[model samples]
Target: MGSMAFSKGDRVVWNTPQGRTEGTVVERRTSDFQLDGQKFTASEEEPAYVVESASSSKRAAHKESTLTRRS
Candidate 1:
């Protein structure tokens, strides 16, 4: 796959304009999809993740490379 080894409910962190943010992995999207009116490209080799922000509970889709597994 595309190194998106995280499973659903896994705690993860990623960088954002506001700085590092933490959240839980809600789903792994392997096909192209739209979220929040934004397009996201994904594939079996380069998957995208639907993550729910721990602080705001806002959901956003992000490429696997942008996410880091957290404890």
Candidate 2:
């Protein structure tokens, strides 16, 4: 069986052009993708992670490589 380590609602940290920000996984797609704003797209090649900043409710997409699991 595959491990469902990260699913929707999971809190994670991802590196952005500005810096690392915290957010939540909003959706899961067969192909990774980014939501609104930002130019970068999300995919396994550049797996996308939807995160909402802890400081602000603002959300953004980030590459999985840039994201880290948070407790």
Candidate 3:
């Protein structure tokens, strides 16, 4: 995904095991990271977004291609 950058506090939606979920973008992760003992792969060319769930407040990392910025 090129030129798709999301800033912190941005509202976004993504698909999850429970179906579509809404959340706020916590940050952009260009480097690999581990959260809650789960490893996430990321790169500048294909960055991942760390987001906080709106309903549960749970945090998870998702690829940019998987996220849609909410208006």
Candidate 4:
């Protein structure tokens, strides 16, 4: 795979099963449950991404393929 152009604090958009949601990158993780000492299990094949909503300030974690950098 290519080096995904994403980092913490980056504004982004993603497609969930429900709909598209916009947010900022709150985290990037490998195949582990512990990120920055907190437990968050996600794999590289299905890595977990943490984001905070642009409108609501709510946060959520999701898969990489579901996310895209905001233009």
- Top candidate on TM-score is 1
What is the clash count for each candidate, in the order shown? 0, 4, 0, 1
Ten contiguous residues with the weakest lDDT in model 4 = 29-38
* Alpha-carbon RMSD of each model: 1.4, 3.7, 1.1, 3.8
- 61: Cα error in model 1, Å: 0.8
C-alpha lDDT of all candidate models, in order: 0.91, 0.64, 0.91, 0.76
Writing each residue's lDDT as its tens digit, candidate 3 over 2-24 gives 76788899999999988999999
Compute each candidate's TM-score over C-alphas.
Answer: 0.92, 0.60, 0.91, 0.69
Writing each residue's lDDT as its tens digit, candidate 1 over 1-71 gives 33458889999999999999999999999999999899999888888999999999999998888899896
Better of 3 and 4 by TM-score: 3
TM-score ranking, best first: 1, 3, 4, 2
> Which portions of model 1 show Cα errors greater than 4 Å?
1-4
Pairing residues by index, what is the TM-score of model 3?
0.91
Give the poorly placed runs of model 3, Cα more than 4 Å off.
none
| lDDT over C-alpha atoms for residue 62 of model 2 | 55
- Which 10 residues in a row give candidate 1 its minimum summed lDDT? 1-10
Q: Residue by residue across 1-70, what tens digits does model 4's lDDT show? A: 4466467988889876778889999987767664345676777566788888887887777667677878
Q: For model 2, where is the 10-residue window of minimal lDDT?
A: 37-46
Clash pairs, candidate 4, are: 33-40
Best by lDDT: 1
